[model samples]
Target: MKDTQPADRGAAPTTPAPAVVTGKDAGRVAFAAFVGTALEWYDYFLFGTAAAIVFNTLYFTTFDPATATLAAFATFGVGFAARPIGAVVFGWLGDRIGRRPALLVTVVLIGVSTGLIGLLPGYASIGIAAPLLLVLLRLLQGTAVGGEWGGAVTLAVEHAPPGLRGRYAALPQVGSPVGTLLSSGAFALVLLLPKDDFESWGWRVPFLLAFPMMLVALYIRRRVEESPLFDELLKQDERAKIPALEVFRSAWRPLLVAMASALLGVGGFYLLTTFVISYGADTLGLSRGLMVNATLVAAVVEVGVILVVGRISERLGPGRVTLWGGLASAACAFPVFWLIDTRSPVAIVFSIAVGIAVLSVAYAVSGALLTELFPARLRYSGVALAYNLAGALTGFLPAAATALLKVSGNASWPVALLLVGLSLLTALGGFLGERMRVKDPVATG
Candidate 1:
C-alpha cells in the first residue's frame, strides 16, 4: 500500500497509506480511463475513417482525387500536430493541479469538437469554409487527445498495486479496441442506409452520439480520486519546478526511445485501420460496407490479442513482445498488401486480422512501457510528449502511404516495402528499449 501521509513543502508526498488499491479501486480507475478513452478515440477515429472514406465527397469536391486526399489527410494530421502543445500545457496543469480535473477538461473538449463536426455544413452548402472548419475542429480534437492519455494512464497506474502495475496499467489501452469496435460498428450500422442518405446524414449521427457517452465518461472520471503517488509527491514538495523541462533535460533519451518504439504499435495500427480501409476501397475497388466488415473482424482479433499480449508482457516484458510484434509486422507486410489486392472478402478479412494480431503485441504494452520511461514528477509530460510526437511522425503515414501507392501504380509493392522498413526500424528500437524497463523507478519513486 502507498503511504497516504502528506509530506513537507517541496518534499514528495509521503506514500499513501497501504490503500495500495488492490481490487475494486484499481478496477474502477482502470475502467474509468479505459471507457473514457474508448469514447474519446471512437470520436477521433470515426473522423479519421470518415475522412478516409466520406470526407472527400462530403467536403473537398473541388480538388482532383489525389489533391483531395492530401487535403483530407492533412486535416486529419492537424489533430496530431496539436497534441504536443496540448501535452505541455495540460501536463503542467496535471502536475500542478491534479489528474482528474485535467481528464474532465480533455473529455469535454473532445466531445464538443466531435459533436460540432456532425453539424457543420458541407462544401456544397458552404464553399471553401467547409474543409477549413474541419481542420480547425481536428486541431481542437488533437489538442484534447494530447491531454487525455496522460491523465488516463496516470489515474489508472498510480492507484494500482505495486507488483501488478503492468497488468493494471494495461487496462486503459483496451480503449483502442473498444473504440475501434464502436466506431466501425457505427459506420457499419449507417452503411445499411442508401448510399446517398448514408453519405448525407448517417455519418453525422455517429459523431453526434459521442455527446451522451462523453457525459457518462465525465461522471465516472469525476468519481475517482487523484493519484496517491502524485498526492504523496505533492505533500512531500518533491514536484519538479519545471517538470516538462526537467523531463527534456534529464530524460530525453528515454523520450526518444518511447517515440521510436511507439511506431510499431500506434503508427502501424492507424495505417492498418484507417488507411488500409481507404486504400482497399478507393484503390482496390472493394465495397465500403465490405471493407468495414473486414475491419470489424480485425478489431475483434485485436481485442483478444490485446488481452493475451498484456499477459505475455507481465511474464516476458513489453520490450521483447514489442520487438517480436514489429518483426511480425515486417514479415506480414507483403502478405497484407497481397490480401488486400486479392479483392476477395475472405482474403481482406484474413489479412487485416493478421496485421492487427501482430500489432496488438505492441499496443497491449505501450501504456505501461511508456509509463516506465520517466520518474513520477515528469512521467505525464515525458510520456505525453513522446506519445504525441510519435503520433505526429506517423500522423500523416496513412495519407503518405496511400499517395505512394497511387504514384507508384504498384500499390501493393510500395506499401509493403514502406511497412517493412518502418517495422524493422521500430523492432530495432524496441530491442534497445529493453534496457529502459530494468527496475522501473517511476512507479516505485
Candidate 2:
C-alpha cells in the first residue's frame, strides 16, 4: 500500500513527505501498468477486428456493400474521435488527484463499455438504433482508453529508478501487441464457426470475455502504489489546478511534435492492422481467417520486437531508435501492399509481420519518450493530450483508406503514398523532439 499521510510542512495541516518505494516495488507497479493497459487494449483490438470483418454486414445492412463498409469503418473511427475529450477530463484527474486512482477508474469504465457491446442488438433487431448504440459504446470505449495510456505509462516510468525508465515504461507498451494478438487469435478461432453462425453471434465472444479479464486487471492494479514523482508534487503542493491548460500554455511545442510522431505510429499501424484486413478480403479475394492469422503471427512478432527495443533503448537512446522505425515504416509502405497483392498467404503474412516489427521499434519506447517530453508537474496532461490528439487524427485512417482505394479503382498507390507521407512527418518530429528534449536530473522528463 502507498503512504497517504499528509506532509509535515511546519504547520497545522502540513503536507507530508513523498512516499518512498524500493526497487522491488517498482517492478510491481510497472507490472500493474502492463496488465491494465493490455486488458483495455484487448477490447480496443476486438472492436477494430470486428469492424473490419463483421460489423458492416450486421449494422449497415441497408447500404450497398461498399457503402456499408465505409460506414462500418467510420463507426470504428468514432471511438478515436472521443479520445481527446477523455484525455482532457482524465488528464486533469491524474494531475490533480493521483495517477493510481485515475487509472483504476479508466479500467472499470472500459470494461463495462466493452462487455455491454457484447450484448447489443444487431441492426436486424432494432433497425438504425443498432448502429447508434454501437457508436455510443465505441465512443465510451475510446474515452476510457484515451485516458488509460498516459496514466499507465506515467505510473511505470515514474515508479522506476531513473536509469531503466525506458525498459520499465516499455513493459506497459507491450500491452498493445499482446492485446492485438489475443483479440486476433480469439477472432481467428471464432471465425472457424459456420458462416451463418459467425455472422449471427460468434463475434461477441471476445467482447464478452473482456469482463473477466477486466476483473483480473482491476485486482492487479489495486495492488500497485502511486507514482513517486506525482507523490512528490503533492508534497510540495505544486499540483496544477488546471493541468491541461498548463500543458497547453507551457509545453505546446513538445506536445505538438510528439503528436505528429504518434500520428505516424498510430495511423500507420491501423492502416496495416484494420485496413489491410478489408483490402486483403475484398480486393484480393482472400480468406478472413488467413488475414487474421497472419496478423496474429505478426502480433506475436511485434511483442518480441517491442521488448527488445525497450532493452536497446537503455543504450542507444529511445528517440534515435524510434527515428529508425519511422524510416523503416516509410521503406516498408510499398512492400506492405505489394505483398498483399501477390495473394499468397505466405507473402501476406511475411509482409504484415515484418512491417509491424519495424513499427514496433517506435512503439516500444513511445510511452517513455512521451513521458520524457514534459515537466513532471505536467507530464500526465501533456502526454495524454498529445497521444490522444494523434488518436483523433488517425482514427479515421481505415475509413479514409477504404474510400481512397475505391476512388482510385482499387489501386494501392494512394494508400502507400499516404503512409510514406505520414512516416516522413514522424521522422521529422522525432528529430525535433530529440533535439528539444528537456534533460531532467531524474531522467523522467
Candidate 3:
C-alpha cells in the first residue's frame, strides 16, 4: 500500500492574516495569552521576592550572612543564565510544532517546579542537600519562564491586525503587573503571620497556591488555536529546519538592537519591584507588610501604565515612544532614591509607582517591535534568544547594585543614577532598531 497518511509531526498549521485579526478575535486570544504570561511571571516574581527575603536563611544560613546572601543571589542569577538555553530549545519546538503546544508545556513545567518548592525541606530538615535541591528547582523554573515570554508575545502579535498590532500585543505584556500584583500580594499577606509562624510554614503557602492557577491557565490555553501566521507559513512550505542558526545568520543586527532595547525597563523592573522590597525591609527598617504593600502599589500602577503606554505606541510609534520613555526613566533614577530615602511610607509608595509608570513606555512597545523584527520562520528563535539574553544580563542587577551601595559606604544616590545611565544606552539601541526596514509579508522571508 502507498503511504497515504500525513506525517505524525503535529496538528496542521492555521494561516490567518496578521493584519486582519478582528477586534473580537484579537481580544479573545490576547486575553488568554495575557493570563498565561501573568501566571508564568507570578511563579517567577514570587520566587524572586522569596529569594530576596528568606532564601538566604532557609537555604544558605550556614555561611556568614553576606556570603549567604551573595550565594542566594548567585543561584538567582543562575536561572537567568539558563534562560537562553530554554529559548533555543523551546524556540525550536515552537517554530517546528506550534506556539500553543510549546507554551502549554512551559507553563506546566514552571507551575510544577514552583509548587514543589513549597514542599522542599529546608537546611535544618535535610542538611546540605536542601539548598542544592532549591538551586536545581530554580534552574528549572528559569528555563520554563525563559520560554514563556517569547511564545506568549508571538501568539498575541501574530494574531493581531497590522495597524493595531502594537496595542494588541501589549495586552499580554501588561500581564507582568497582574502577576507581580498577585505574587507581591500573596507574599505580603503571608508576612502578616507571626515571624515564627511565617518562617516555619507560611512561606510555603504562597508557592502552593500557584498550582490551582496553573491549571486554570492550562485550560484557557488549550481552548485557543495556533497562530494564523504559522499556518500560512506551513501552507507556503516556509518552515525553517534550524531556526536558531538561521536567526543568527540572517537577522543578527535586529537581534542585537532588540537585546539592547530590552535591557532598558527590565533593569528598572528588578530594581523597583525586587530590590526595593528587600531594601525597604533591611535598609530602611520598614515593616514587611509595609514594604510589600509598596510593591503592590507599584504593580497596580504598572498595569495602568502598560495600558496607557501601549495605546500611546499605537499613535506615536513604538520606537519614538520607547526612546522618550527610556530617557525619562534615566532622568528619574536619582529622584527615585531621594523619595525612598525620605523614610516616609508615602514617599516609598510614590517612588515605586512613579518608576513603574516611566518604565511602561519601553515595556509596552517591546513585544510588538521585537516580533516584527524578523520573518516568521525564525521569529520564535530570533525573538526568544534576544529577549532572554537581555533578561540574563539584567537579572542579577538588583542584587549587584544593592551590594555596590553597601560597599560604597551607602552612596545610594550615585549608585541609583548609574542604573539610569544604563537605561540611556538601552534607549539608544531601541532608537536604532526603529530605523530598520519593516519586513513585508511577516510570515516569510
TM-score of each: 0.93, 0.94, 0.93
How much RMSD separates candidate 1 from the native structure?
3.4
lDDT of 3 by residue, 97-203 (tens): 88889899998999999999999999999998999999898899989988889899998888876677777878988889988889988988888889999999999
* Per-residue lDDT of model 1, residues 372-411, tens digit only: 7666667778778888888888888878887887788845
lDDT of 1 at 406: 71
**Count of backbone clashes, every candidate in sequence:** 18, 3, 4
Indicate which candidate wins on lDDT: 2
List per-prediction Cα lDDT, in the order shown. 0.80, 0.86, 0.81
Report lDDT (Cα) of residue 50, candidate 3: 89
Summing lDDT over every window of 10 consecutive residues in candidate 1, give the lowest-scoring window: 1-10
User: How much is the lDDT of residue 61 in candidate 2?
Assistant: 96
Give candidate 1's TM-score: 0.93
RMSD of each: 3.4, 4.3, 5.2
